[model samples]
Structure formats: structure tokens, C-alpha cells
Target: MNIDDLVKGIAAGERRALARGITLVESSREDHRAQATALLAALPKEREALRIGLSGTPGVGKSTFIESFGMMLIAQGLRVAVLAIDPSSSRSGGSILGDKTRMDLLSREKDAFIRPSPSQTHLGGVARRTREAVALCEAAGFDVVLIETVGVGQSETVVAEMSDVFLLLLAPAGGDELQGVKRGIMEMADIIVVNKADGDLKPAASRTCADYAGALRLLRKRPQDPDGFPKAMMVSALQESGLSETWGEVQALTDWRRANGFWARARAAQARYWFEQTVKHTLLAQLEAPKAKAALSELSDLVAQGAIDPTKAAQDFVAQLER
Candidate 1:
């Protein structure tokens, strides 16, 4: 397909083109990387969608919640795109990518698009191509882009860096639950929602909300959150209750950050972070070239045998690369 046609199709919200664009960026081939870079450069500089990062502990019903939340957004006439990051099998390097099946209703909506990418060897619970996928979605005129993490350790902090609003979902549990989550992750949350707040879990969900609200009070607020500390609420994604209110909170926080100039600053910082990551990745890839790899192996053998000091060996490797 012509690259110009692909870019135009994406800007016009052609679903097939958007899917292909995402695939292009996710590929690791050098040619694909060049194409992806050109595609990103063609995209508009201004953000056209709200980037939301949703994360939680395992079994928090993140998929179900996103299905419901995404439907709600669609009903409001918003075009929603979901980039669901699924864990890859360490042995096989494959993922189920079953989020579409899990979010059947939302997936069927013409105004909604869902793509599940494997988090293959990428830490922080997100797919390595997530940032690029988000850019494609925004360029495709998606009004809201939701990034769902794999619910692994440290994922919340990582996703928080990429999103306009970071929402932490919790199950209806007690203070013991709080103990398991990192404080830094909690502090990063712009909003917190206790899911499954229906039936027998309703009371517990309310209590959990209160517990989180209290805990948030004790933590220092992020400088970007001029509206004060994070807000906690209860929602029953299955019953589809409190979803509107939750969305309202998200919008309110987004508005607050934009009004305070924090949004622009945060995006600038994210760009810098990604730029540094690209440079590091490029340098590491260069170090894996055949000649460099052979040199590294020799250095490793020397260091392991104590024939040369580790620090000196590293210096020698750098010198060789320079030469």
C-alpha cells in the first residue's frame, strides 16, 4: 500500500488503514521502523484525543470495566480506541490477544476500535509499540484512547507517564489490599475506582473507596494535580452504574490539568522520555551487530576468567566500538 494513501486513510478514520498502521509500527524490522517514523512525522502535532491509562491488580475486572466504559463513551458520540496490552508467554513469545472476545459488545461498535498487542519482553506491562499506536489512533480521529496495561508490577507508574489521566482500579477489599499496591502507583493516580460495586460487594466497595480516599490524603499530591489529591469512587461495570460520574471525574481532572498548564508540561516530559528510550534502544541494537557481539563475547570470557577487570573490559569494549 502507498504510504501516502495509508496516512490519508488513517486521517479519514478508515478502520482497516488504522489497523494496518498499528501493525506497521509494532513490527521490529528496520524497514518497518523507517515507515513508522515517516507515518508519525506526517501526523498532526496537536493531540486530538484524551489518552487514558487504566491499570489494576489481576482479577480486578479491567477488561469488563473497559468494555462497559468504552460503550458509554461511544454512546456519547465519541470515537474510542483501546490498546489492550496482553502478557506474552515467556516460553513461546505469543499472546492470546483475546481482549476483543472479552469486550465483545464494545468491539462490535462501529465507533470503537480495539487492538490487543503482546507485551513481548517489554517491562512495565505495556507493549513496546503502545506510544506509537496511540499516535496512530489520535491521528485516526479517535476522541478517546484507552491504554489497558497487563496488570504487572510497576505498570501503573509506567502507564501514568504516557496518559493524560491515570486511573487505578481496585476490587472491593480492605486495607490489606492497599498494602500490596505500591505507594508511588497510588500517588500517580488521577482518579481511583473500586469496581464490582454491586450485589454483595456493594458495601465492601464503598468501604474500599473510603479506604483509598483516606490513604490518598496521606500521600503527597503530584504537582500536576493542582485540583489536589486523587479522587476515589465506586463503580459497577457489570451493572454499568456510576460510569457517567466516573467519566465526569476524568474530564474534570483533565480540564484542571490543562487549565494549570500541567498537561503540556507532562506531554513534553513524555516526549523526552521516549526520545531517550529510542536512543538507548538504537545504541543497544548496534552493540548486537556480529563484530560487536564477538568482541563482547571475548570481553565476557576475559572478565569471567578474571584475566581482566570488569570495569576495564567495559572500557575496552567502548574503545573498540569507537574504533
Candidate 2:
């Protein structure tokens, strides 16, 4: 389809058109690339949607949380789009796309779109095509975009790079699990939520929240919003308690970022980072094919055989390109 027609259809909030838009951006064809860029350029320039990142341990009920939260938002007359990324199965190397099933209620909402993508060899827990998907969402008029990341270590930071608000979700447990999470991820959180706070687990969740609040006090708080608190909260996804509080906290975060200029900066930085990564990956791909790849393979064999040192081989390869 032509770029103008595609862009018009997407702007009209046609779900199929939006999916096709993302697919075009992901395509490797040169004509598709040009069409994608032009189509994106033709869309609204300054997007005002909220980009939120949700990440936690694998069993921390992330999908359930999203289902509840997204449904709440949709009920409030807000348009929500969830860009949920499920990790590729290590054995089968495919995404089950189970988040859609987990969020059955939210999946059926007309104003809500839940797109499950495979976290395919990207730096963070997100799929490499996530940025394009996000842009498409923004252009298609989603007021909020929630990007869920995999539970991989340091993956939270990757989510933070693209989101205006970075929320770190945690189960109400202490000890080695907390230690397994890196301190750097802790510092990036604008909000920390302790899940499973209802029924028999309320006290445990409360204590965990206190402990996290104390820990957060030692680190620098992110620049404050007029209404938001940087403190931790205890939530129970199963009981739907504290879900409204969590949503309120996120709203404050969104307002602060948009008001205090952090929102624009965050989006701009994300764009620059993605552009640089795309270029670097593209260049590496160009050099790793056919003749260039075969020559590099020979150099590796030579280095292993002690015919040439690793550094010398690298330098010779660079010189060969110049010649």
C-alpha cells in the first residue's frame, strides 16, 4: 500500500492498519524502509502519549497486573496499548504470546490493544521492533503505551531508556531474590510496587515495602512531581487492591515528566539511542556477509593457529578495507 493511504488508515485507528504499519517498519526491503520512514514522518510530529515500562521477576504476576491496570484505564475512558514482550523460549526459541491469554479481559477491550512480541535478541527485555511498534501506537492515538520487559538482569534499565515512567514491580519476598536483582535497577525506579499484599501475605508485603522504602532513602530520588511519592506500595493483583493507587502514582509520574520537561528529553534520548544502535548493527551486518565474512573467518583460524596475533589480525583487516 502507498505511504499516504497507510498513514491515513493508521491515523483513523484501524488496528489492522496499525499492525501493517509496524510490519512495514520491520521489513528489510529498501522500498519498504523508505515508505515506512515517509509514513512515520507524515504522522503527528510531537506525540503526547505516556510511555510506561513494567518489569519484575517472572512469576510476579506482571501479566495479571497489566490486565487489571489496563482494564481500569480503559474503563476510565482512556485508550491504552500494551506492548508486552515475552521472552523467546530457550529450547524452542519462540514466544508463546501467553500474555494475551493471561489478559483475556483487557485483550477484548475495544480501546485497548495488547500486542505480544518475541524478545528476539535485543539489548533489553524488549523486542528489537518495539520502538517502531511504540511509534505506531502513538500515531494511532493510544493515550498510554505500556512496554513490559523480560525478567532478565539489567533489562529494567533497557525499559527505562524508552519510558517516561519506569516502574519496578517486585513480589513481597526478601533475601537472595532481592540480591539477585542489581542495585543499579533499584536506582532507576520512579515507583516500587510490592505485589501479593492481600490475604495471608499482607504483613509480609508491608514489611517488604518498608524495607524497600528505607533502601530507597539511601539512594537519590528522581526529581519529584507535585503529587507523586517516591515511596513503595503494597499491592495484591489477585484481590485488585491497591491497583487504583498504583494507577494514581503512575498518573503523577506522567504529569511530572510532561510538566518538568523530562518527558521530551526521555523520548529524544530514546530516539537518538535507537538510531545509533540501528546504524551500528547495520554496519556490522554489512561487514559480516559473504567475502568480508569469509576473510574474517580466515583471520580467526590464523590467530588460533598462532600464525598471527589477534590484535595484528584486526589491524590488518582494517588496513585491507582501506586498501
Candidate 3:
């Protein structure tokens, strides 16, 4: 479909058009990139959604938690969109993209949309175009957009820049108090949820929650957060318990941010961040041209043979590109 048609369809909340729009945005082809830029520019900007970034270690039941949590939102008559990022195989650059299969029920809901994309070796656990996808979902009228990262540890913080709330899901007894106190992913989380809180794991989940809560206390409070913010909670995604309470906390935190005017400022900062990132990526992409590639190869060989220093070679290569 043409850019105009896609924009109209997205404004009308057509699922097919929204999917196509996301795929267009994620494309790296020059022609598609041009089209994606026009498409995004034409999209309605008035529509907005709550963007939540969810991450966890592998086997932490992120899929289960998302499915249960999404269902709860849908029941409240909220449209939900999930953008799940699957890690790409380093050798093959292929992704299973099996999020739809995993979120069986949510995928089937008329109000729920699930799109899984390959990370394509992008670092920080997110696909390079995930922010665009989130924008499209919001323009398509989703009340909530959930961004699920590849779940790599600690350094997987890029999602926080794009999301209004960052949730860190953990398995019960996964770590002790000291581990929770360590900075990095722990420091980035707005809410640390201990999953599998039902049945046999109840006690362990509670203790884990308390440990993380204490850890949150030790960390310096962010100006954006209200009192008791960045707290820990336990949930049982398997049995769908505590899902409502979790949702309540999410809403409460969001409301607090909105009331204090932090929400708008945060989104503005995110937009500026992505703009800078896009410019950098565009410049890097230019280096993939055949002439540039050849120049880079020659420079690498010269540096390896000690004919030129690596930094000087890089400077000369960049100068060649400028010319």
C-alpha cells in the first residue's frame, strides 16, 4: 500500500495496515527506508499509548507474564500491542520470532496485537526500529504498548529510553540481597516483579520481593519517581494472580508522573534521543557502500601491517568519505 493509504488505515485502526507499517519501518532497504520515513511523518501524532518495557533473564516466564498481563488489560477494554524482540543468531543472523506462538491467547484477541521482530544483532536487547514500531502501535490506537527485549542481562537498557515504565521480571530466589543491590539492570527497573508467586514459590517470592525492595531503598531516588516508587512486588503469571494489583501499581506510577509533568518531559527527551541515534545510524549505514567498504578493507590491511596507525587510518577513511 502507498504511504497515504497506510496512514489512513492506521488511523482507522486496521491491524493488517499496522503490521505492514511496522514491517516497513523495520526494513533496511533504501527505498523502504524512504517510504517508512514518509509513512511515519504522515501518521497521526495525537494518538498516544502507555509504552512499557519488559525484560527478564531467560526462563523467567516473561512470556507467561506478558500473556497474563495483556489479557488483564484487554478485559479492561484497553487495546494492547506487544512488540517482542527475539535475539538474532550471530552466525546466521536469523531469529525464531516465536512470540506469537508463545502468547497464544493474547495473539488471538481482537484487541491485542503481537508482533515479533529480530534484534538483528542490535545491542541493548532491542531491535533498532523498535521505537518506530511503538509509535505505529500508538498511532493505530493501542492503549498500551509492551516492548519485550531479548532479555540479555545488565546492559540491556536501551528499552528504558523508549518506554514510560520499565519492568524487570525475576524468578523467585533468582538472587540474594547483595545481588539485587548491584547496579545496572537493577538500577534501571521502575518495578521489580518476582514472578511465580503462587503455590510452592509463594514464600520465596515474598522474600525475594522484600530483598529487592530493600535494594531499591539503598539506591538513590530518581527525581521522576514519587514516594515508594521503584518498589518490588510478587506475581503469579501462571495462575494469573496479582496481575490486577500489578496493573494498579503501573497505573499509579504513570498517573504520578503525568500529574507531576514528568511524563511529557520524558517523552520529549526520548524523541531527542532517537533523533540523535537515527542520525548516527544513517552515517554508519553510508560506510556500507561498496566504495566505502573497499576503502575500509584497505585501511584495515594497512593498519594490520603496521603501515599506518589505526586511528590515523580511520581519520583518512572518514576524510575520503567526506570527499
Candidate number with greatest TM-score:
3
Instruction: Report the candidate with higher lDDT, 2 versus 3.
Output: 3
The number of clashing residue pairs in each candidate reads 0, 0, 0
Candidate 2 C-alpha lDDT tens digits along 117-167: 887656578887788888899989999999999877544577877787878
Structure candidate 3, residue pairs in collision: none
lDDT of each: 0.88, 0.80, 0.95
TM-score for every candidate vs. truth? Answer: 0.95, 0.90, 0.98
Question: Which whole-number lDDT from 0 to 100 does residue 76 have in model 3?
Answer: 96
Give per-residue lDDT, candidate 2, residue 28.
62
TM-score of 3: 0.98
Candidate 3 Cα RMSD after full superposition onto the native fold (Å): 0.9
Segments of candidate 2 deviating more than 4 angstroms: 28-34, 90-92, 175-182, 223-229, 321-323
Question: For residues 1-323, what per-residue lDDT tens digits would candidate 3 score against the true structure?
Answer: 58999999999999999999999999999999999999999989999999999999999999999999999999999999999999999999999999889999999999999999999999999999999999999999999999999998888999999999999999999888899988788888999999999998899999999998888898999999999989999999999998999999999999999999999999999999999999999899999999999999999999999999999999999999999
Query: In model 2, what is the error at residue 8, expressed in angstroms?
Result: 1.3
lDDT of 1 by residue, 104-142 (tens): 899989999999999997888788889999999999999
What would the TM-score be for candidate 1 when compared with the true structure? Answer: 0.95
* Candidate 1 lDDT for residue 138: 96
